[model samples]
Target: MRNPEKKTEIRIVLTSDGSSSVFNPEFNQHYHSVFGALQESQRIFLELGLYAAFERFEQINVFEMGFGTGLNALLTLLEAEKNQRTVTYTAVETHPLSMEQARELNFDTLLNCHYLKPLHEAPWNRPVSITPVFDLVKYEGRLQDFQTTNRYNLVYFDAFAPEAQPELWTQEIFEQLAAMMQQGGLLTTYCSKSSVKWNLRAAGFLVEKHRGPAHKRDVLRAIRL
Candidate 1:
């Protein structure tokens, strides 16, 4: 269970891209990049991660490590609606934002979409169709406690930085994710630290560094082998 005291401390902050992101003082981290929240999700998770998976798989099963603000899921839902593809998105979040806090985010206004409300309002621990093409199931717990029978084709590793949550970036966690993914599945994250790259490789993934969004220099994309 998340500390209620910590949950109350979450604040909404505007990113460089004019998107609103949650700032958790507990970890001293922003849910998205301070540079640009929307830009980061669109470029890294949607373009690099999901679109790449779409090429090989008829239907995409996506597992997200952090579902903060639901930005990635919203972007993915938009793509699924546009391309008419089927997507099953499962997100694990230990401390979720309240609906009031979720409503305060400007993602919908920035993206000119209305799915953000439904995405947040959707019930937890059950599949809910946000749209005909997109089905979402959110698990309200730590990633370690998350269990799923479905093997994901694409994973958005949007966890807080290593300094904030080192345990989640360990080889053990990467290995667990590797076990939950299909062969050749792709995992994309904003982190490209040497330790993170080493852990991914040690956990049986082929790691590659790519140009990051906005102010970031490089990000990582790993393939399960």
Candidate 2:
């Protein structure tokens, strides 16, 4: 369980791309990069994570870690519409944002999207259709406790930096996730630290480096083969 005292002090921060993210003093980290939230999501997750897999498969199943602010989910939902593909998105978060906090985010107005509100309002632990093309199931629990019978085609590993939450970036965690994926499944993250790449390789993934978005130099795209 997340510390209640720590949850009381989240601050909203505006990124360079005119998108809003939260800064958590407990973790001493911002939910998205300070440079640009939307750009980071699009560059790392949408373009690299989802679209990269779309080139090979029509419909995709995505599993996301740390679904903060629902930005990546919203972006993936938009991509599903653009490609006319079906997307089943499942996200797991230990400490989810409150209704008040989620409503305060400006993503709806920024992206001209009305579904952002409903996405946050959707019930946890049940599959809800944000649109006909996108289906979302959010788990209000930690990833370690999550058990699934379904294997994913892609993974958006959007946790905080490895320095902040080292447990989530370990070889055991990667192996666990890799076990739940189909062959050739892709896992993309904003982290490209050498230790992270080493651990991904130790867990049976072929890691590739890619040019990152602004302020970040590189990101990782690992394949479970």
Candidate 3:
């Protein structure tokens, strides 16, 4: 059974089959590290999306919908260190990764050595200074009710697929995300569904299609203009 959170209504489970993935009942697919999951996250969201968005924010606020394996958070911290940029990262995961599950991820080969532990060991909801340039703040909450008094420079809407969780991908949700983003800020996601693009437009984002990484034809990158 999945634990419930007030802000988000995501249900997550451990595969327990030595597959190294957190299962999403909605998508019927593991969220992170199921099929080269962390690598794809690093390539799509961090290296391609967040780092590019960082060019505009000396101080970045990242609102991540699903913390999952904390891979994106880890990658962001590493990128911040290399770029001399500072990040205030906020991630939401109702069901977080256990120590055993975290260890099984084997991201040590993909990421350099220094980031392995801090990425896994960072305490939940407690703002920690993982590096001089990176500040981590996690919340065990839901995405629907994640209200911030402030706005973010980047938004990673990496929730389960819209089909699995329609609640997270609604016009209302996109409207909320758009409202919480800073002017001219960016939002990126692996999904490029027509309904998603339409909802983004309805929420006031200027959306564009971009070349996706290996085996993916396209991705959506939207700007809050």
Candidate 4:
């Protein structure tokens, strides 16, 4: 069952970088940072998350905690194109935005990438080819129900804020994610709380606090060791 707290209305808000993010009334949280949605996604998830692992593997597998607006996935797709790499990305979201809600996010025109339309239109729970280089599979379910059958090389831990959804940032969740990654796999998030860093350490990850994107001070990048 979907968490009752995540069932609230989602409203679109423009971020600092002229990108739009969804604000959830229940948690009083924004899917991406209020600083700059595109800047945050590019810096945290792409630069630190995907690119950090891309050089080591010819073909990579990625798992995202919450696929919210599909911004991270879209950026990853663009990176794959630039590097001539292949990525199989699987994203799980307990609460997804409707087509109407998704269209409100102007990423397609902002990034000059027209593939965003087919990405949101693709059915859940099935892998679809977004491009010859990027394959995507989206699950309409909670992370607890997720079975780590396909190990991932990189993890986009883009869940709600730790204060709002503390359960998702626990040691158990980190352990589950660690078990799903290959050795030296990278996990990145825009969270830098001390407790979160400690939990990642307990989960056997070598955690590092990196300089964050605009407005934010620090973020996290952990490597499975």
Top-TM-score candidate index: 1
TM-score to native of every candidate shown: 0.96, 0.95, 0.85, 0.95
User: Per-residue lDDT tens digits of candidate 1, residues 104-217?
Assistant: 999889889899999998888889998899999998899987777799999999999999999899999999999999999999999999999999999999999999998889
Residue 217 shift from truth in candidate 3, angstroms: 0.6
Instruction: Enumerate clash totals for all models, in the order shown.
Output: 0, 0, 3, 0
lDDT of each: 0.92, 0.90, 0.75, 0.90
Can you write out model 4's per-residue Cα lDDT over 14-121, one digit (the tens) per residue? 998999999998888999888899999999998898877877776799999999999999899988888889999999997788877888899999988887778888
- Deviation in Å, model 4, residue 98 alpha carbon: 0.3
Worst 10 residues of 4 by lDDT: 1-10
lDDT of 2 by residue, 1-225 (tens): 444343546888899999999998888999999899999999999888898889967779999998889999998888798878999999998778877788888888999878788888888888999899999999888888899999998999998888889999999999999999989999999999999999999999999999999989999999997
Q: Predicted candidate 3: what Cα RMSD to the true structure?
A: 4.4
Stretches of model 3 off by over 4 angstroms after superposition? 1-21, 24-27, 33-35
Flag regions of model 1 displaced more than 4 Å.
1-6
How far residue 167's Cα lies from its native spot in candidate 2, in Å, is 0.6
Name the candidate, 3 or 4, with the larger TM-score value.
4
Inter-residue clash pairs, candidate 2: none
lDDT score for residue 191 of model 2: 94
Error of 1 at 197 (Å): 0.5
